[model samples]
Target: MELNSIKDAFDRVAKKQKLSCSKSQEVIDQIIQEIEKALGKIQPSLSDYKHVLSDLRTTLKDIAPLSQLEGTQKELNIALSKYAKVIEKSFNPDIAKAYRNIEFDVHTVNQIIAIHFYRQGFFDIGDCFISEARELESAASIKSSFLEMFQILEAMKHWNLEPALNWAANNSDKLKQNGSDLVLRLHSMQFLEILKKGSRNEALKYARNHLTPFSSDHMAELQKLMACLLFTGRLDSSPYSALISPTNWEKLAEELSKQFCNILGYSFESPLSVTIAAGVQGLPPLLKFMNVMAGKKQEWQTMKQLPVPVELDKEFQFHSVFVCPVSKEQSTDDNPPMLMPCGHVLCKQSIMKMSKNSTKSFKCPYCPSDVEATKCRQLYL
Candidate 1:
């Protein structure tokens, strides 16, 4: 909502600026036109035309565009001031305090961020950062790997698949282990390209050498591809036309990126990107909480944990977390999750409390199993 308000304010300022410019231009044009008319009326050979010059000046002074231009400039200034205030109010001056006393190693952070830029193909920026930070060795190791991946992706954008095909084939075993059908997908795209270009025979041959191997597991999709051959160059009008959607290329590129990252044992997203995204999602609540606790200086300063939970999407959830039903507390190293014989999980603290400091067996909170806390196994995520 705040974003919308800011956008509206920006739009108003832009509109006012354009109006002011148009009115100013109109005023200048009118004055020039009146002076030209006055000059045309005066004799070219005559050095005297004082009355004509006076009339031109009077006409210029009476022009409505001059007053309109002034009003527009005033409106433009008002719009600009309003936008400035909106921007100022939108920023929370105390937001920086949320990172109070947190220590960061500048060199290490620069190296990580620089590597992230390199991985995203911002080589010049990354190089500059590395040079300034003098952390060449740190970013040098993974640079070539990301550069190669980018090269392959760049080729994929132009519908070339040979580089990706060879890479996938060389890493065939790893792809298989990871259950990635990247090679098959790449081959399918190649086959579709052949079919699109009116080469039915080539498409069939390509599919036979490629898609046939995956028939056992991908029989349905294989059948669809085979049916697409009937349409040949007219696949756009075929029942399987959805297969030829331009978005398929985008989806394939995304899938290829995921497969590439998986093969390298790295996350599909850059760590820096993920960190920034998570921060963007979590910062608002933290800022609001800080504003609410502004009066409690000592309490906020000494607080080690957030008073409220910051919810993030499942995509950002990188690990399993167990919250104890009894205590309504999250499991940590000091209070690890425990699995009872009844298959119910609870934090160690909750189990300890329920078992009365291991003095006796306790019934499961949601079940009838009476188990000893000592016998409960620690569960790791």
Candidate 2:
């Protein structure tokens, strides 16, 4: 059948007189009880029951014209109203099946109802739709439902959340047992990013409650997240310093500098001090370097400032005591090199080398700037 024609037919049937509001609701309640029973009983081979039920519900509205027999037509119309109630029950897993039939008719139906629930602050219903979409094995529907919740969260401006924290807390063993390293890391990073931009109370709550578990392995990312959280008033203080030992302080500082440069297009040489000043604890390496570099510059620019002066220092100073001259064979003009914040050393020659590669955006070793090789002061280390 043509799509429009099918839609018209369904609309007609949906608007048609069938069951009274009370009778329809009762039928809906009965269907929901059946679904819950099916779920709880754990049928050995109910492979396509949900799909069958969903399709049946859709057909009840649209297939009336084609279905033969007098009673079949009536049955179909009654089923449509009933299925909607089932959807409501499916959303609340805790609801008892024997609840009295209420005459409250939802103004919306099906997918629209799911959307309304999401917008109306009924997250359990939204989650039910998500679960159903997943059960139906529709990736698109699952993603759509997930995105809807995200939009809701955005609307609430609760970017950082306790749900994410609770998730991490309760599922640690499951995550580890199931080898969810990448997913866990991604979730952690995303949650931390949100917290960094949240209120201090909430951010610190997240840090104190959530940051402790993966501190050792993902310290670099965590430190950066914490720093941002503190700066943004998400965290009360640098709650992660104790996690990072003094011996590893430089490493943490370096990571922070690099991350800041990466995230904010600014670098700090004394990132640790800046973190400390912000009342945060540990500084990643990159931030430390960036803070120091910024402090030495003729014009100092912190996170608050932008468009700092760009002075490319030609000479390079290697910070490492065990520095060895890069082999000439390994050296090429095309090799992209970076200068450290102290104008000390060149790192990553490959980023500069290769024709037109210099045009690719990179940080100045001496100062973090989005620039091409022409702006770089060639370091003759």
Candidate 3:
């Protein structure tokens, strides 16, 4: 759906409604002012009361408030009608038509939700879910892994880096294998924290013991830390003030959390988050396609793949997409790509059709090699 176009239509409707309301209020105010003026002109005597009433009637008729109100009401009605039409055109109110009845894995759904809770650092709630759900003992191990991550994060909250530094030192080899500079960065933060306590000697000792080893790879950064010793407690007032920004701490904490997840063989974002985000982006097209199918009275409920492509943002694409060269169709679980013995790939459906339902051999369309449908192996990607 074109959101900008819908927004433009909505803005037009809102503007029209505002203008109509403003005009109506203005006309009503004018009519009220005229009536009040006519009332003020009356003398305080029963003899003059009937004469004042007669004058008010003629004055109100001259002001013509009813005609003005009718005109304003007509404009408001027109605006409302246009607004309704715009909503109908831009939105599909019957969104339930987009999906069909299908079986779902209740246990797997529960597991995903539980893991999401653990990844978000809600271990108590996650434990509650695990305790309530049947046969979910496996999630206990997953929760244990995240416990260390949250522990380090909690320490970093209080300006304490001991837990994080210890974890980094312990996993220095694995961290290097992942090409991560997390260890050195952690040391640098710790060094700065020590310097901030007005302990120049302690800071120098920390630099020599922990920061010197990283100097071979990060000489410039290490030199900056050494230079910071001159400014001592007044680092914020010195030329190295940029290092005092809270963003550095926040960014390092985030980085530590990410790498910790990576070391545990998990994505930085929880799987549930990725799925919901992708689903949100893909839902519009699916809903639109379903609407079209419903209009045509066609059946798409049992189709293995969506009739239309659901394009999602790049960040949501965690894996590669393979499109078959022979049939020009994207691969899905039901119709996965098959790798032929001849070093060629095609969709399983295409190969089955070409080989006459696997009853006979057929020549490869891209090459001269004779192929049998049974000889093709399904490729995962």
Q: Is candidate 1 or candidate 2 better by TM-score?
A: 1
lDDT of 2 by residue, 1-381 (tens): 334554555565555434344455555666566557555544555776777567656645553323333444576667566655555433334222212234543332344445444434466766687566543343335345445444533432433434433433454565465454533443444444555455667656756665666788778877776566445533335564333233343443333223323332223233333333432211232334444564444432223222222222232222322221342223333442445434544434533552155666655434564555544454543
TM-score of candidate 1 to 2 decimals? 0.75
Per-residue C-alpha lDDT of model 1 across residues 133-251, encoded as one tens digit per residue:
88888777667777888999899888888988898899999989998888888899889989989999999999988889999999998999999988999998989888868799889
lDDT-wise, the better of 1 and 2 is 1
Per-model TM-score on C-alpha atoms = 0.75, 0.20, 0.78
> What does candidate 3's lDDT look like per residue over 232-264, in tens digits?
888888898778678888999999988888988
All candidates' lDDT scores? 0.85, 0.45, 0.84
Pairs that clash in candidate 1 = none
Residue-level error in angstroms, candidate 3, position 148: 4.8
Instruction: Provide C-alpha RMSD values for all models, in order.
Output: 4.7, 29.2, 4.3
Better of 1 and 3 by lDDT: 1
Order the numbered candidates by TM-score, best leading.
3, 1, 2
Model 2: residues with Cα > 4 Å off, grouped in runs: 1-160, 181-205, 233-381
lDDT of 2 at 348: 44
Model 1 CA lDDT for position 67: 68
